[model samples]
Target: MISIELIRKNPNIVRASLLKRGENLTILEDIIKKDEEYRSVLKKLENLRHERNVASKAVAELKAKGEKFSKEVKKVNKINDEIKKLEGVTKSIKEEINEKLLWIPNIVHEDVPEEEDKVIKEWGEIPKFKFEPKGHYEILSKLGADFERASKVSGARFSYISDKLVILEMALARFAIDFMVKKGFKVFMTPHMVRSKAMYGTGHFPRGIEEAYKIEKEDLVLIGTSEVSLASYHSGEILQNLPLRYSGFTPCYRTEAGAHGRDTKGMFRTHQFHKIEQFIFCREEESWKEHELLRENVEEFYKVLGLPYRVVIVNSKDMGNAASKQYDLEVWFPSQNVYREVVSCSNTLDYQARRLNIKYMEKGKKKYVHTLNSTLVAIERTITAIAENYQTEDGHIKVPPTLVPYTGFGEI
Candidate 1:
């Protein structure tokens, strides 16, 4: 959530940033108007309380003097009633303002592009194949992808992989963890389910509620990414460190409510998948620097796997609610003859910190920390990429040499 103080102090700046995202500007107007009313009500409530205190004191003095104290007591009681009413009004207005604020997305950073089609960097060569390349689903069907059984057991958008395919998935996850650990990140296997507050703190709730799986009668929601748990780890705490880096590995679950029929063929779009996410908490001024480091880390991950990929700046209108700027790394798929997103790196800045109440003390002053998250690897998605790119002409799959050590085999 944007700070009320920022909205009050720099409405124009806020408006300009949101305008770039094509947001409805009316909410800004509504918030400003309601905030004024809320402040006015609070002032009235304060004055009423002061008046009640004075009247109550007068009543005490009158009783001590053995004089009539009924009038003073009545005045105090009447002021109390007014204060109670004004307090309700203030609470209502504050709730309204906060609701609007929560829905308002983070302002896009100036560096984010207006279009996502522009590739910032392209790496490796698009592989050449003599025979026609089949999609990952067809190729993996012979190898261990059993969507038919997965659907029978858990409905559509789920997959059951055994044999070498499952081994490949685990190897990918382990490789990603080791890669992130070398990048100054502490690895954690976070909880797969988290409270609603954790989702909201990461700016995933309200807007993204429909896309998440929730417990029927509990406050828990299945995490879409380990980013949610990682970001909320230090919620409401004041950190003494300048920068904290952590990587989380978890099996994520999502409803895929918005992606109904899209990418339904394979594990590309699934309800459950393992992911390793890189998260960082740092001082506000150091966030941009950390953002670049995150980008480098992601690029290196794909490079080591010998995957051809390109990085693009996600358009402001296309980015998630929390990210100020996002970079998506798209891996080249030989079968599709195009690139597909395999990694997304974003710098949310202090938007999440404010919501989670995560703060850091600097020279005795407390300030909200800036947060950033990037996907080291979405196991299944990367496996799909590898399956397509490293497929032999005869349909067998060749494992990336870098992952051979983890998988204990060169081919799957």
Candidate 2:
């Protein structure tokens, strides 16, 4: 939620930001009017309450003097009733304003490039194939990996990652987790099912609700990323630690409801997949620093895996609703002859922590903590990158050297 104080103080700034996000400024203007009305009603209620108190005192003094006070007492009671009615109106208007403010996106960072980011650096070379390279679907089919069998059991956009692929997925996840853990992140395997509060706290609800799988009976939703669970785990709590870092591994589910006919053939867009997610809660002053550190960690992980990848800062229009600033790491896909986004790092600033009430107590002060999250690895896409970038001439997949120990094989 935007700070109402900020909105009240600088409506112009708020209006400009809303315009940048392509929001309906009419809604914000309505909120401004409603806030004014609410304030007027609140003043009326306070004055009436004050008058009632004075009248009650007069009634008490009259009774003490053994004089008639029934009329004054009745007037006070009537004023009290009117104040109660105005209070209800005030409460309703306040709720209306808050709901409108919640829908507003965060203001983009000033330093974020106004234009789409250009690749600043690239690592490794796109693997050259002796023979025509096959996409993951073809390679998996030859290895007897069965999406058809998975579909028979669970329906489309599902797969049974069988044969060596299952091991490969584990290797990818384990390798990413280990890499993050060594970099001061506390590793965790978080819950898969989260309450609606968790979803809203992470800014997944209200915006991405349709893309989530809700457990209506339990009033819980399957998380789309471990970032959701990890970021919201400390919701409504005050952190004693200044910089709380957590890296989580979990199986995530999404409906992919909006992507009709897109990446429909393979695991490129799936209903369920494993992910290693990085989440951080830090002091507001340190959030941007942590954001870059998170990006560097992702880049180093991919670099160690010998994947050709580059980092690009996301543009405002494409940064989504939650992220104030975002950076994406796109790995080279040999078959596609282009880079595809595999990891996203974002500084949500206080956008999420304010909603979650995840705050921290400084030595002598209290404030909302800033939150940041990044994808260390999403298993399906990472596997896709590996399959395409590390394919051998004879159709075997080369396991990245960093994951060799985890998979217990040099090649798959």
Candidate 3:
């Protein structure tokens, strides 16, 4: 969500954001009209309350003079009724404005590109396999994974994820937590199911229902990422701490609503998965630094795994409604013969903070905190990269040097 105050003060700024996101500018004018009517109602309500006060005083004066005050008392009662009616009208108008505000997205940063995503940098070399490298699904099945049976039992895009593959996935998550926790990020095992309010606060509600799985009876939805939980942790609170950092490990669920028949062959687009997310809260000026720090952490994690990858700056048109700026970490998938998105880092600035009502006080004044989040480890994709890149011609997987200690074996 964006601050209405910003839009009220500068409509062009908000207009430009809407235009950059490929939205209709006319909606802005409609919002302005609605806002004006809301303000008009409030002003009338205030004046009515003042008139009621004055009428009450007149009735009291008439009674004090020992004259009949029935007419004066009747006028006071009528004014009170008018005030009560206006109060309800005012409440309705306010609710209307709030619902419209939720539909408007956050403003994009000025420096972000408005066209296609830009590749900021690339890392390592795309490995050259002497023989054609098999995809992870084909190779892993030979290594003891039961993907065929998993599909038979649960449907497509499902995997048994058994044997050494299970250990490797767990090892990837544990290694990420160990590395990030030491870097001053608080670790949490967040809830997989969150209420609609939490989803709304994280800028995932209303728009996210298409991609989210809801428990109809429980009024809860399964989270797509741990960032949802981490972002809502400080909702409606004033934090004395600046730059609060948190890492959450949690299972994720998604319907992939509009994405039908895409990435359907691999774990790249699963209905369920595990992830370790990095979420941050900081002052406005320091948010960019924190954003880069998160990107650097993801880059380093890929480097440690010896997987080739690249970082791309997501353009304004592509950056989602909640992010002012964002970066995608695309890792090499050997069998796919191309890089795939494994992680995304975003600096939402104060967009999410405003929605969650998270604030911090400085110099006796309160301000919304800036928020940023990134994925440290999304187990399935990371495993796809590792399994494909480290596989030998002999049909075995060579454990990456960094994860070897954690996995307790050189080969599987």
Estimate, for each residue in 210-290, the C-alpha lDDT of model 2 and write its tens digit. 999998678899989988888888888889867989999999999999888887666778999888999999998999899
The stretch of ten residues in a row with the least summed lDDT in candidate 3 is 93-102
TM-score of 1: 0.96
Local lDDT at 59 for model 1: 93
Q: What lDDT score is found at residue 68 in candidate 1?
A: 99
Model 3 lDDT tens row, 1-412 = 8666777899999998899888887757777887888788889888878887888888888889998889878887888888888888878876777777777777888778888888999999898889889998788888777777878888877777778888888888889999987899999999999998888888887666689998978979899999999999999999977889999999998888777888766677788899999999999889999999999999998998899999998888878668888899999888878888889899998888988999999889999999999999899878878889998998889999999889999888
The count of backbone overlaps in candidate 1 is 0
TM-score, model 2 to reference: 0.95
The candidates, ranked best first by lDDT, are: 1, 3, 2
Best by lDDT: 1
* RMSD vs true structure, all candidates: 1.6, 1.7, 1.5
Candidate 1 lDDT, tens digit per residue, 219-306? Answer: 9999999999999999999987679999999999988898878998788989999899999999999999999999999999899999
Kindly report which residue stretches of model 3 are placed more than 4 angstroms away from their true locations once superposed.
none
